[model samples]
Target: MMASPYLQCDSEQKLQCHWGLLLPPGCVVIQTSSSLTKMGCGSSIPKNCKVGGKGRKRHSIIEEVAVFVPTIRIPVDSDVVHPLRGLVSKELVDRLSKLRAHVVSLSEEIFLLTESRLEASVEFRWKTLDDDQECCVSSAWYEVLSVVHMLAMLALFEANLMLIPKDGQVGGERKVSEDAKKDVVDSLLKASGCLDYSVHHILVQIPAQVKKSFPCYLQEGMLEAISIQALAQCVEIQLGLASECEKATLSVKRRLACELVTYFSQAHYCLSGCDTSDSYGKKLLLFLKWKCMEAKAVAYYYHGLVLDKGAEASNHISAVCCLSAAEDLVTDSKRACLSFCLASPITRVPPPWGIMKNMHKKIPDAAYRKFQMYGYLFEQDKNSAHQSLPDLPEFALSLKPEGYELPSTDSIWDNVDSQPQIQSLKEHLNDEEDEVETK
Candidate 1:
């Protein structure tokens, strides 16, 4: 249950609009008293006007809201990633639902505001995990929709990490209670749902012309990796619970491990389409590889146990080989884990807490037992049969990531055309712009 250090937001766009002459004469801003509301301007910006050309500042009669986009930072040179606004966890889903609503409302507002060039585009700036600088995409409102969704999902995931229960010490006895695990499972599912929408739904809505140009954060491959990463973590947590249960069978544990391997390997494969040139990508690849290797260790160990129950000599030999492979994989994964921590923008690796932590205790002892069973046979038979690792049995995944649907367009958009004063305001603003440019 390790959390990525990449959290927080430095990507901000101050969104302010003067509505005195924009929206219909009586239109008032919908949001109030929150991050979105505090910045929402209900009238003219005070600094932009001075009473009788004196120094006194007061907001004019123009009703408006100041706008801001909280973009997450991508720290390449430093290891500081900040969380979005506050812990969005308490109201996160609602907050996210409102984000699309806000974007929809803003798009309509912008269209009315930009009477001059209906071609005016909103700039969406964000950064990928590996980059030092923020990336910008200016186009349709869906661009903003897509980026905001990514940030929301990321926030949800980071919050879920905070929710994970920690045992007092890192040891072989996995004693975390089932009740605690249940909550994290719910959070993980929500995170996966956001990720599911990011790649599958919202992404496709982005205009094709600007789609390919989006930063790695919005790209299909990276989104896929994050999505699967969430699922992998969920499966890991579930496996931890299963491992702790006395009633659980060997097959059930192996099934969970095999599924974990499925997610980690798929996530690693997604990285193939991404640009691994950046420090983040490189570090991520190492992490995925570590996870993949670790999953294999747990999977093979449980598989060896299941096979050991069979009656035939071949079964025993195969079980011995599986156990041996599991031991070697455990070693390999440890090395990979160290490499991940030592990568640039270095940070401490999370202490082993879940399945791998418990497996560490079991693999050596189990392998010892398997080898002990085979000792007499090797001594009795001069020519021992060659034993190579057998393929781990594949099991159908017990879990599937939930799908997400974007909220319907904000209700405010329904009355966009009904605002008669909007046209006159656009012409008025345009006329003012023309006078300044002409002068």
Candidate 2:
């Protein structure tokens, strides 16, 4: 991958964006957009095929991870291969248990042991989402944990995408196996837990002086953008499960849809308040826009279904408007999705999986069927079709951030702490530090 301009801003405080794959201590990842056009579920949407709303399709989406390169006080000087982040993005399903163990080992034994949070004096730089041009720099070790956890979540997300069977048929969406659905759910929950740990356990502890240097991604709001969106996506998959069940009720479907809306809108609300000056942040916000609209559409469509059960003519009119709004939102969301994919560092939308895999086809068909049934409203102009639909009723959140805690500091630190040692900064930099000269 080509290097970023920010990589040169401070030669010693370098960065790399590759997910830390068996990362060496002295070097960091720069913002390199590894081409992802053909990888996992992140590939382009199939044509002419009706989609299941399993995934909100995108043309392309950028992925990022980071490593810091500097000659300053080193936080992690030992070679650390993060288990989750180190696992090949694909072929990781079998390794998840081991991956979890590694997460604790690396976090407590290696990462926390560095105590970069309290003692590091050198600047550490890391790239943020979606953008390769800018990076966040800090000396605090917690920033490393926050970013590493987020990056690991992305690594696991790919494994979930890979577990989903391919959708190649032109006429019908394939049935997702229960095993696949369970795996997806389990993986998503783990991913959410990773971010949960970062936001609550790691990011919260950053010293006040360190907080001011944070990028929007490191801030609570944008981190929520990542955290809650994972939950929303998880709920989207569950909604698909409900749709597949012959016994599931409209209320069940409606509840899931409402929950999806709440989760995505919560993420969007958090994203909107943060700075998006970077290219990655801008695309992320746009993608969240698409997600919010899609969830709203799904909720309205199901809500309209339940409302239509009532005998009142007013109920029928409102149902008509809800369906109308659903259709509009679907259209708007598609446009917004396109905008996200077309933004800088282009990416393809993953193939549809879950209910959304079929959602694209289902919504339009349902809306059309509902519209015909409610035709009399429009025929007599009972209410203007242009009138806004009712806002979605609020629902209690169905998903919560998986609880997470950093592993306790490794016993290795006990030995190191007992012995006192002194080393000159000059000697540390000259002998141990990987000092990079810009020239």
Judging by TM-score against the true structure, name the best candidate: 1
Candidate 1 local lDDT, 1-439, one digit each (tens):
4323222112122222321112222111212112221222212123454312235454432221000111233211110111111211213223333432443333212111222222123343434322235556554333434433543443443434344333323222334456646655655565566667666655665567877776555567876776677778788888887887899999999999999999889988998978877665676688788889999999999988999898877778878889999999998988987787677655455557677666777898889898998856545654656366888888777666665443333333344432223235776577567657755
Question: What is the TM-score (0 to 1) of candidate 1?
Answer: 0.68
Q: Give me the runs in candidate 2 sitting further than 4 Å from their true place.
A: 1-118, 122-140, 143-147, 163-176, 349-352, 377-388, 422-439
Separately for all candidates shown, the number of backbone clashes (residues 3 or more apart, or on different chains) is: 16, 31
Hey, what RMSD does candidate 1 come out at? Answer: 13.0
Worst ten-residue run, lDDT, model 2? 65-74
Residue 310 local lDDT, model 2: 90
Can you give the lDDT of residue 225 in candidate 2?
74
Q: After best superposition, candidate 2 residue 206: deviation in angstroms? A: 1.6
Kindly list the per-residue Cα lDDT of model 2 for residues 68-160, writing each as its tens digit.
100001112222212122222222312222322333222211232243332343233333322222333434354355444544444344434
